[model samples]
Target: MAKLDLKTADVPKTREDARPPDGSAPIPIHSRARFSGWFGYVVLVLFAIISLGPIWIAVKTALSDSGTLFTSASSLLPQHPTLFNFERVIGLVNPADPRLQQTSFGKVDFYLALKNSVAFTLLAVVPQIAFSAMAAYAFARLRFYGRRVIFFLFLAATMIPSVVLFIPNFILIKDLGWLNTYQGMAAPYALMTPFAVFFLRQMFLSTPRELEESALIDGACYFTIFFRIVLPVHRSALATLSMLAAMNAWNDFFWPFLVGRDRSVQVMAVAINSFRAQQAGGTPDWSGLMACTVLGIIPVAVLLIFFGRKVVESLQYTGFR
Candidate 1:
């Protein structure tokens, strides 16, 4: 006799008991996921607005007419926008006229200060990059006496406040007859930046040892390996360092003011202060001042915008590896 089919008997029947009485549709997982994504985007948009609102306001104010800006209330958008303020403050309005201070446009002296800043940056950054890279290479690759001690000394320099060194630096510059000269303003502080050495040393240390070892086997010198191999691989670090150096040089006011008394040697930041004092007889031209500030910041902003990704990526890579 054939055995009874027990598996078919155990199967549940699709009768009244198996069915839900309400007959309501179940919620879709995709719909819930879509709602979460939209919520995340909304939060991001709000954060972006919060972060960018102030910068937008400043730009709007800078673009607005000076008369309207002073008389009118604060606004996200200017009622009557104009480029005259920027033109005036950036020296596009009046190319000549030494005594003719352009309240709407910036002074020619401002441009001169910009030139001085560029010169100082170039003079300082080249040597600083070279020396720092060399020091970092030696620290990372070479086996030398007192290496740890020397590196520690360099690291210790970071703890010392820059203000404490100002007086001594002034005395040295005075003795060298470099006061009021570009050398006095840029040189003393340029090479002594321990941060550069430290940063570059870390980058060098993070490089694969086998690459350098291979280069050595191929009869390449340390400098050859560094210049030919390491530098190319770490272009991001170089870009970041260059941008930092340039920004520091351009924005340096206190040291330049102390060392460079001569109007000819004054940098843009120093010149802007002098302009404010001279222009504001009783009331400061907030519009013009803001305009100049905006102009002065453009180069740095542009640099960062273009190279910021590289800077961030390099830092992240250095940190991780």
Candidate 2:
């Protein structure tokens, strides 16, 4: 019943014929898409530059020589790039040098601060991760009375500004005689934070129930299931949480400044402040300061660089719900 349109089938459509029947110019969709893609790339590059500029400046300053820094401060690259600044920060600089004696590098005690920072981070991160994971499991898998109400209350606690809690928390810590102690510095953060709890809870909720059920059938306790089944399945998520917690603990300034002012317990952040103060009424050891900052950043930077993919993969599966 069909008549074959052989002539039309053989003929190629011209650009004009490719236009819609109404006969306005066809949209240059491919060109528009290309333009949009280029625009997005430009925006991303711009944001990257903005985000990384300061860090680049810090590195540049750190690499610069102290004597030549003022002369070449405006230059992008260090005029005389040297490791002397780094050596100075680490206290390997020759003390016999007159220039070294004039500065406050002796008072900075960077190694002590570094040790304290590592200690504080460990004390905060280990207990926090352990407690947060257990609490998340309870919220996600176990049934108990007032669970919803208690969980909501925990969520509500996140809405409360941290600054508002500082006074009460400070008074409590002071009353407990935790000032200038590593324990005092770590105590506030050692328990579960709402964000960590909420993060792990979402992950736990997403895990397949079948494995947990099977484990229970084998006469496994909740602890066994959590330790043997759940934790191994979500190791990436736990690593992500640890990295985040480490960064937070390392960079914290105000609280550590309040509670851990003594040199023995001072962290890297407070050490920077003390370094600046020791150089007061004089030209700051700009190179040394920047070097110290770079050293402080290296550990976390190395962690992120190595475990960055795990962090991204874990975050990819995280649901807003």
Candidate 3:
């Protein structure tokens, strides 16, 4: 038997000192918040107020009478609050059956614009999420040639200004004869965004690899692992992403404005502008414009409210598991 040298004796590792025998990185220590005192709360309150100020103003102005908005533009509160602007903006929207649009005040009724917005937004969001999740799974789990280089390219794409793509994208739309079409508004956004892929990739990395390995041993394939395990696990993250994409699609202006030639497929954002422009064919209706803007924000705001906590939780998902 060989005797161990005293100088070369191995020391036993405690939980804290143990390193992975496989040479993988150690799991991090995730400490609970060492939260600050009242100062923290005060700071958060101040920040919230500052953030909500513009929204509050918009809502207030939307509620205010047009005469008041014109006469007393600086007033913080609506002295004589009314829903005339909202009512006008919601023209011909039937309470019993809301799908169909009828004519009353505006060129394009609100319900039709809303349906178009939903259609466009869904087109952009659903496929983007599906493909982004797949790409993200590949990035996080699969080992393939040029993976690093390809992912680097994807990361690098996000850094380029979107404005740079506008002209080229417009030309492509023009060439494809998709200009002023709903498909045109939806097509450019249907693919995976670099950030969405990146975001979901990071979340995927956080998921337990052991789960996948176990699934594989159970004769489950990649698709099964992705759909059953990965997607269900990261639903909060997906909701946050979907909400973000939907909001962008819903509130999108420049692209919709550029491509939207008529009211047939008009989204809320473009319709609001055209509505405002037509209303202001002579003089600008500031109250109506504000009201339209406020109305446009409601769906996104409601989504945030419902999923806000989940979004916050998912932000912490990328932290230590």
CA lDDT, every model vs. true structure:
0.73, 0.83, 0.76
Clash pairs for candidate 1: 88-105, 88-106, 89-105, 89-106
In lDDT terms, which candidate is top?
2
TM-score of 2: 0.83
Q: On residues 161-197, what C-alpha lDDT tens digit does candidate 2 reach at each position? A: 7778888888899999999998898997899888899
TM-score of 3: 0.73
As for candidate 3, its clashing pairs are none
CA displacement after TM-score superposition, residue 125 of candidate 1 (Å) = 1.7
- How are the candidates ranked when ordered by lDDT, highest leading? 2, 3, 1
State the displacement of the C-alpha of residue 179, model 1, in Å, after optimal TM-score superposition.
1.9
Name the lDDT of candidate 3: 0.76
How would you order the candidates by TM-score, starting with the best?
Answer: 2, 1, 3
> Candidate 1, which ten residues in sequence have the lowest lDDT sum?
1-10
Q: Tens-digit lDDT track for model 1 on 1-321?
A: 112222333322334433456865533334444455556667779899998776667677778876677566556677678876677666666556542443444344557777888888888787888788888888888999999999999989878777788889899999999998989988865675787788888888887889879999999998899899888887877777766666667777778888886889988888778877765557666667767777787885786698777655644433210
Best by TM-score: 2
Backbone N/Cα/C clashes per model: 4, 0, 0
Q: Report the C-alpha lDDT of model 3 over 146-182, residue by residue, as the tens digit.
A: 9999999998997778778888998999899998788
Extract clashing residue pairs from model 2. Answer: none
